[model samples]
Target chain A: MANGSGEVVRNRQVIFRDYVSGSPEETDMEVRESALELRVPEGSNGVLVRNLYLSCDPYMRIRMRKLDVPSYRESFQPGSPIIGYGVARVLESGHPNFKKGDLIWGITGWEEYSLITEPETCFKIEHIDVPLSYYTGLLGMPGMTAYVGFFKVCSPKKGETVFISAASGAVGQLVGQFAKLVGCYVVGSAGSKEKVDLLKNKFGFDDAFNYKEELDLDATLKRYFPEGIDIYFENVGGKMLDAVLLNMKLRGRIAACGMISQYNLEQPEGICNLMNLILKQVRMEGFVVSDYYHLYLKFLETVLPQIKEGKIVYVEDIAKGLENGPAALVGLFSGHNVGKQVIMVSRE
Target chain B: MANGSGEVVRNRQVIFRDYVSGSPEETDMEVRESALELRVPEGSNGVLVRNLYLSCDPYMRIRMRKLDVPSYRESFQPGSPIIGYGVARVLESGHPNFKKGDLIWGITGWEEYSLITEPETCFKIEHIDVPLSYYTGLLGMPGMTAYVGFFKVCSPKKGETVFISAASGAVGQLVGQFAKLVGCYVVGSAGSKEKVDLLKNKFGFDDAFNYKEELDLDATLKRYFPEGIDIYFENVGGKMLDAVLLNMKLRGRIAACGMISQYNLEQPEGICNLMNLILKQVRMEGFVVSDYYHLYLKFLETVLPQIKEGKIVYVEDIAKGLENGPAALVGLFSGHNVGKQVIMVSRE
Candidate 1:
């Protein structure tokens, strides 16, 4: 698989077709072959890397729309290769921090290779004791998202009741385990029974419920959290949010990590019970993980040990090739993926 | 005019007729005469007071319904005398904190005379330098609500942009003044052109708008706050809240004081733009002023001087007697009152 230095190579890329309005489909993106030089362009401080594992995240769905307002990320260009977080092996570098053959993880392309102009945003993969694929889910952005959301944002105290929506997803799974580590009671809601089982049996949630089967979400929440929720890690929004508002305890905190449920709709479902926020004296805060990247090293220190000791676990649903990337990403909207959805682009 | 140490008197009362749905009407309550004893019951720690000024607040509308969940205030009991905040003169007291001839402000009946069993909750009026009617608006519950909500909940900084809804109402008026005092640029929205004029010209708000005239609230907010709102004192909810969510600046804070717009509706309006809270990394919190009563003395220390120096002013829409109490309270739902609506039950 080794190519001569500076040799021209064929790169397979997933290209976004156009701006999306409703639920994104596999046809919205296409896998195509493009030519690339296996070198950083002369006089440019860019790092050329061959992407390995690409992360299929819900937030990417937001970037598919033509955002009329300010957002943390720009909308994906219609004809360009889709940009996302991925594990990559640096092929050539003109940057000070990165070198050829160095393994890294950060914002890369959904293609086999990418020319990253801002390589400084990339983290050098220092601890490969865990599988490199973990960098795309457990040990990378999602893990850091869980750490910041649960510990910094929600500030859960011992014995507090915690609830996570999309519980078997990458970030929610980690949040549940972190709550357990803090000695808080944790319950989770997912779209399927298998995911529910994984939350309770594998991730150590105190209880789990299949939200798709529940006719009344407020009643379902009451059944799971009889004492009321002290912390809610919001991933799926809309009706789930409205229902959770009714069941929040006094001074409860909701960390708005993502709203996967509403991203694909032309009109996001209306949340009707925000009055409960005032009645219960609650705080709901929204945050971006990039704001807390300065604490990434600190996060790894706290989480890495737990993973090694088997105190924390991550479940990933891996698609075996770059060709399957679009389906894996689109599956998120339909709750078709059982866990953390990842595209395995290459072995090295 | 003085009765002997103890005597029976005719007490005119505003009685809640039944649980109300939709817009509360004057017919929901009735003016009636009932007998009252001027003395506290034997060995009872109660204070019998002559109600003078009864505060008519928007939150009272919520109490007209049958509340099935927990709330800061109890539902108005059907067939019972309506309860509310008022300025009163103590006629008798078995409680050590109060005595006969003392002036107090707290929860009292919508009647000429009330026997307050929970006299401890009442604040004894210390300085009569200002008008006694001020206690019902500027120096009592609504005043404390504005203080805690602005200084404590919003944590507004100098030069920040503040926007308040229901701006000429009891609490919003004070919040706007407090924000201006903090060196912040403040804009307010009210229902009537007269109220809007009071906000800008009378209350010294930087700008004000008549919300009723603005068909597109979001566009109106954008016009008023071109730089985006940093702190929003949320007094009216529903469409206004949804619009504010879209116009909030980065890391903005929204203090949910009350939602007068949704109180009388059978189904509260759905908020569709809460996703902006995430996109902007915003914090929206709901609070009840009762939680901050420990800081009342501190609040008075800060506000009383402003009143004395003519740095702050108050406006009241005083209804003549207990007979007008129902209409005064009902007026809040229709935006009929100009400022703080207070019913003068008795001059003495």
Candidate 2:
């Protein structure tokens, strides 16, 4: 029962093969074409949107594994299209909030088109002056994650020392910039020398290091932060976390944003230094960005100006098409992407 | 340094033999008799106190080891008298805040007599209506630890579910009682059936389990808290912490008061389920009671009344004489003590 204007169209989608055990491979996802009606079903409050860009985040790996316990985000169905944060343009809507052509970003399918049953989860893009792809990272979910984790969770004080793991990534890069803006001494750790250079020169971090080159992370951290770190924006966990735990100052705050290093393992690495949390009186708090969406408008009000004025800079690694989505997503586990990894689904 | 009233006395002391590596033994400490001048030296701020009841706490295990990093407490000096929290009667005082005949509880040597140079660290016993031995457990540091950790750190709401590890210990018992006072459903885990019984019957905990009897802690936790735990009073770390992480509800709080299980280990157990913190959006905060000592008066105001009215109860495992102090202290690591382990130095 489709309208003449709402014809069935071929949708290119990335489907999750099965529940992953260890490190995810490109084979875990299959790019397949499926037919989808270009309209929300009658009497349903769903919004049909044309997905433009999809994010490749560390947290996605957690979703790939079979979860025994309840989690914030649901596991992606094996046969269904991979779901993630993406920038999309509304094609049709049965909801009162929209009619057509509204730019939005939130939880969407890693496909050409998505029928978002929960339209309320998608946020309408207000500032189109910025790149549309920014909604997949810098101006969207990851951006809010950085803002909430650093500002609210870490509660950074000016002149405090901050260390960030996976500092070249989407959330970490933004946290580094935010820390700098607040007059904090920021140090970042990345896998590659290029990312380290970007952290120091482009992201305005006080210091940066290639974690791969460092033999002892604890010693390296001691060298970077002689007095000990005040805030640790944790993205990479395992050894980095253990090392950071050793180097944290008294009353230190660790915002547990993501633990990428432990996500792909059969068994997560043992965190031996958590006892330091007591000795240092540290508060390690974990947060999901969805919980802070109430502060979204406030976040936008604060960050939009900084982005426009060049006070904050965001680097992105954009893959050209949905067919390349599997490789791009898999590459994230290997630290293959230089910055915010995004799959460019469609230009229009 | 001779005084008309002051006289030399034979002081029986427990001396720390050396820096310990793994599980501390009674041999790690030596009982020796030393001569002490029962007076505060002329023009000095030190207060000479006759030690009465010495506290045998798990944190003493951490101090037993040689620490490479800066910690809240310094390492126990080898070949010196073992230092810990104890009740004492001041026989001589040069400090303005303290005077002769004043009863105090704080950092004191595990000996018959101790000359405390830092008198400010000690709290003068205002309400001696309670047992003097209570100062080492129910009315002193461990009590304050339970108060700050449960009320301030956990931020528990009424009708919430709470789970405490090492529930029969000094801090855990009080925390359980406090949780019950706050109108929360409380569950606790101890090593023995007797301690578990004490938690349920004496402490008014809603449920209790012997962790040693439970093969799968996660399953046991699921059984106890069908709805996930809201607050976790973390007294024991390692496998318990990993298990607790899995059972925590959304936005759950874990007050990392102490980690008795991990303290004596050469290498602390690797925590595998810390990722659950992010997934559940939980907060695991480590706090030392010293940070909240400003509220000691307020804590006394709250807890003293409860103790008097029989709303709260304290269970203590008293080891008689300074000679038995080492066994009492070392027993903590093995879960041998049924409750708050204390050493009675002298009745006076």
The DockQ scores of all candidates, in the order shown, are 0.82, 0.88
lDDT for model 2: 0.91
Which residue pairs come into collision in candidate 2? none
User: Candidate 1 residues A1-348, lDDT tens each?
Assistant: 223458889999999999999989999999999998887777788899999999999999999999887778889999999999999999888898998889999999999999999999999999989989899899999999999999999999999999999989989999999999999999999999899999989999999999989999999999888889999999999999999999999999999999999998888889989988898999999999999999999988988898899998889999999999999999998999988899999997
Name the lDDT of candidate 1.
0.92
DockQ of 2: 0.88
Candidate 2 vs. true structure, TM-score: 0.97
- What tens-digit string does per-residue lDDT give for candidate 2 at B159-264? 9999999999999999989988889999999988889889888889999999988899999999999899999999889898998998999999999988888887
- Say what the interface RMSD of candidate 1 is: 0.7
lDDT of 1 at B48: 92
Cα deviation in Å at residue B51, candidate 2? 1.3
**Highest lDDT model number:** 1
Q: Candidate 1 — which residues are off by over 4 angstroms? A: A1-5, B1-5
Candidate 2, residue B114: how far the Cα is off, in Å: 1.7
In model 2, how large is the Cα lDDT of residue A255? 95
